[model samples]
Target: MKKVFTIIVLWVAVVGSMTAAEPVKLLTYNIKGHGMTDSRLDDIAAVINAQTPDIVALQEVDNRTFIGIKHDYLSELAQATGMHSSFFALVGSYYGVGLLSKTEPLSVQTQSFDPSDTSKDKEARGFLIAEFEDFYFISTHYSLNADDRDTATAWAINFARKSDKTVFIAGDFNAQPTYRAMVTFKNNGFSILNNTSAYTFPADGPTSCIDMIISYCSELGQEYDVAETGVVTSVNGLTLSDVSDHLPVYVVIDPIEESGVNNATETREMRLVRTSGGFSLSSLQAESMVNLYAMDGTLVDSHWVDNGEEVCFPASCRNGLYLVQVKNGYQNSTFKYILNH
Candidate 1:
């Protein structure tokens, strides 16, 4: 009896240590290309900071050549949010996939899945993997076509299977949860984070679900709890002001260590994504009203502006949410963004 008790105690100690050492707070965001008209890097940072995710996977990043400023988009994001950054160029020119982390990742890897030899655009797809002590995170974007998405999903699952480690995958899949590709992810041990199937594409006019965050665990016993998962509705009351066509998906995982954790609310920086449409007056005003009554009365965002500084034009006012409010009897504005995955 004494020996059996000692063995049980030892096993409990080992289990406790493993659970406590696991990384917490992982996230994925598709920051639309960092470019001139859509310079919402600060806004993206704000959203990221608000979530306080330890690991982040990003898609549609600009290398600075074709996009806005001639600065590395991932680097700018890391600096702004005080996080580490890594990238894998898929198109060669500017567009690519990237990873960002507040907690330093142990092992980072980037792989290109482009099979077409036609050109950069035809071949612009890849994955970014970053590992924490016991968790591995992957971020990627899939082709709009069903066939192409299948190939991407296969590659993603194979990579995750290569290790028995706990894994998380996030990005703009461009495929719905009911799609066969998503089913494959589940069969391979990855489960979708969001319980309800919510639309993520076309941030303003989301019609169907696309973006996602998937996780892999042994079973329900060793499984990580999804604290919260849904479309990120607003930033500091700005409401996602058409930052992109796709609404951002936010997912939080509970670490084995803590329970009943509350999400932290913080003022976010700004990010602008360049798009076809020009800026909106709403993007330049403070304390403006933002409404997204698209089939759901629950989706709402509004805010009052405390600062009244013009966010500048042909530079700062890219694809994102701008604050408009009365300041010194003049209208001032700040900016944020939603990257369409």
Candidate 2:
């Protein structure tokens, strides 16, 4: 029994000239249980205030634990930075992950991940979601176990799929970019927004990249552009290693405006149909330029297509996932496709 499958994704579309909105700055950090003294807390707040992020995801936070001297670390940070905060306990009311934002969230929700096994040694991990007017921000701490990390990734993806607004997730994933969990995120439509080459762990002399910020926009017609991204190793004149064990990572995003001169009042449409040879594109705009790229970003083929014309895949193209970018006048759109031969 031979089977063949061709999967096409028509969800992502960009049709208009993009206008820059007020960029949203997001930060993620693991503060090593917020240190042990008030001075340490002040140092952490200094780093955060210097960055001036709109939203912050904090991991390894302590809340009135025996070691924390009954102090709420997240509350202290929120007060110090003049931002709203929410905490989701992962190990009773003692340890957890938290979120701090400049504006109050519209709503907040939390969920605990399922343990990998029935072992008391396994640490509990959870995620918190805060809904804003235009997007949803998530803060989470994934378990060290691979199975548990996969579970957490699946949970986040399911949650994002059900949301109507754009989704941004940040946390100490405890997995590298090449890890299975990270690959799963990309397969589900999320894109890692931070630089993977930079390390974030062991703030003193980082060598591992375990903390990350990723985003997914479920809306087919909406798009966001990354304006800036960085791994914060120092704040002002102070080195961040003195305050936390992991460096903070931040990303600035600008929403792309959907209205532009080209096809502003018309609906632009394109279709990819599987053929006996490979595949063909139909219904493209007049003088549309098409580019085929492998998942690894290698250009496979390109062509200038016209309305009612057919553009077939190159014979040298392999069986795998690819990106098809079509440009017509001022309009541009990207589509994901999978070919199994």
Candidate 3:
């Protein structure tokens, strides 16, 4: 009887590890590139690799511009990451949104919304819908205008509802959680996966979780789970947002059929040297004004320091995400780091 009980316990543990609750990683990045250099593409690809995501939703892309990579970004990223690819040129063949997937999607389509009632100056926006083996993976970018964001999301929600397949959507919403589109989405049975206060804009220092993910599994409540949602901060020691204005937002979705509970994960500590004296900046050869901003883009504090000097936050400073900007009269550099309380 004792041997049988031990065997049962071991079997359960092994099954749990292989459960669908281990979400396939998904990432959304706005890679700011109406015209990007090859070196820039490499930098962006490096950042995406650090996370090892299962799929990625990318925007602000330029595909094969004359002076650009001279190759479709979808193909470039596929080559860079060894993923399959697709694209929707919202403006033209050169500029639009794209997707990179580790597995071949069953079907793919891009839908452009009718903005007849929207502002004329508003840019044309679209969404990418790729039918994966398990779910409908979607992507969109909302308008900078609050009202337009509502209109765009309304269209996207309508598109998503057209099919009953489990839907996983991601993009740069431009509207925060408090906004109307977001409110409507929440009310209409959509769940923001990484819907935390973690901001992901102005990569120099994010203040809003604009880049986001939303998921809807018809049986999610009964047989599925969203394991984790977060912002991807850095690659190597260099900061993102320095390359593009927005950081990557990610989500992990797991399926749970048996009686199961959510698994908690530890927060990843960013690799930067720090102490009680506050964190020190990397070596620079210039005297600079080291300005710090809260995740919401609020200027928390600033200091004048010589090159390679260590700057400290106030004693009253609380813990969260903060961005560091080092400016000399001649040139400026930005760095983003975390402050643990």
Best by lDDT: 2
Better of 2 and 3 by TM-score: 2
Candidate 1 CA-lDDT value: 0.61
By descending TM-score, how would the candidates be arranged? Answer: 2, 3, 1
Can you write out model 2's per-residue Cα lDDT over 1-341, one digit (the tens) per residue?
12222222222222221233567999998988844577778888998998899999999888664465667778888999999999998887868899999989999999897676753438898889999877999999888888888888888899888877889999999899879998898778777777666689889899988899888776542446666667887677677887888999987776666655444335445555443334444433345788989988999889865422235667777788999898886457788888666
As a whole number from 0 to 100, the lDDT of residue 340 in candidate 3 is 79
TM-scores of all models? Answer: 0.64, 0.70, 0.67
Cα lDDT computed for each candidate against the true fold:
0.61, 0.78, 0.71
Candidate 3 runs further than 4 Å off = 1-22, 65-70, 117-121, 219-223, 258-341
Clashes within 3 Å, all models in order: 41, 0, 6
lDDT (tens digit, per residue) of candidate 3 on 242-326: 6799988876655444444442221111122353356543323234588999888999898865422346788777987899887
What local lDDT does model 1 show for residue 206? Answer: 71
Cα error, residue 49 of model 3, in Å, equals 0.7
Worst 10 residues of 2 by lDDT: 8-17
Candidate 3 lDDT (Cα, 0 to 1): 0.71
Off by over 4 Å in 2: 1-20, 65-68, 118-121, 220-222, 260-341
